[model samples]
Target: MPVPHERTSKKKFYRSPGGAARVTYIRGKSGRHHCAYCGGLLHGVPHSKGVAGTRALSRSQRRPSALFAGKLCTRCRATAVEEAAKVKSGFKAAEAVELSLKPFVLEAMARVE
Candidate 1:
């Protein structure tokens, strides 16, 4: 890729009030996207593809494209998977505790009584 020539700013009027700054554009430059998880440059390539059939019976049951749809970048995604595996393997899955309004209702009933 060719480097763009150095840009020179235009002279501003002394008496005029400033509204917006001038926008500059290079001939061949385009916007680049970064990773969703790590905020690193994605460059030109996508996340890696793991060996086939590794997740054939996985509970998540999502396609590889769907799984990596968020563009997390391979390294960060790997680290996240490692952390999740550590948590999942070391501990049993806990049931979600439902929040109930029964306590508030009981308090109100007591106040009424």
Candidate 2:
């Protein structure tokens, strides 16, 4: 039988539209704290003992982008950016040209309202 949505007390964060391509994490498991930049598990073997310290120090310490592997799902993010570009703004087309390509920013804006 297929595993139920909330198996083993794990909470699932499904991809928008809520289905497959979903990601779930158990409270005390490696996936419990995944990197916000990439979906990779943040705290566990091969990774730091815990990201809490790294995440906190990141604000003060310089970090290289190579750490996150630059892997991100641009599907929804691209849509949000397209939606924002549809509006006129003082940010100017030239400046926005760059922000428009940032997956997290674009996609995040799209989901709002």
Candidate 3:
């Protein structure tokens, strides 16, 4: 049996050159980051098995630098900006925005000039 920490890890079997069987444990890889609004995979985020692995990456390598970089995809960011503009211009009411998009729109509005 594997140690306590590796109990949940997957096992791989291999044959040694001396004709002995060996087992190795492998921890699972982390899933890719996803956009908060669109539920699509976010780019520029590192995939690592543990916190230590992630910490090894530099700040810029961990996530994008743009606004809502880790949370929203480019397309959704554009949509939020557009919705915010409409709300600010009186073309769309604050309460009229979809609930899923309301928070993002408001965030964009806050950052606008």
Best by TM-score: 3
Worst 10 residues of 1 by lDDT: 92-101
Off by over 4 Å in 3: 1-8, 13-22
TM for every model, in the order presented, reads 0.33, 0.26, 0.78
What shift in Å separates residue 103 of candidate 3 from its native position after superposition? Answer: 1.1
lDDT for each residue of candidate 2 in 6-96, tens digit (9 for 90 to 100): 4666666668675657766656433344444445443322334356755655542423333222233344334434545554343445345
Model 2, position 35: C-alpha lDDT score: 46
Greater-TM-score candidate between 1 and 2: 1
> Global lDDT for candidate 3?
0.88
Pairs with steric clashes in candidate 2: 77-107
* Candidate 2 stretches greater than 4 Å from native: 1-27, 32-49, 56-72, 89-113
Sorted on TM-score, best first, the list reads: 3, 1, 2
Clashes of each: 0, 1, 0
Our model 2 lands, by Cα RMSD against the true structure, at 15.5
Summarize candidate 1's per-residue lDDT along 1-113 as a digit string, tens digits.
Answer: 32335343333334324665654443342345566656776644322323343345453443234323335566755554444443445542312111242332233234332
Question: How do these models rank on lDDT, best leading?
Answer: 3, 2, 1
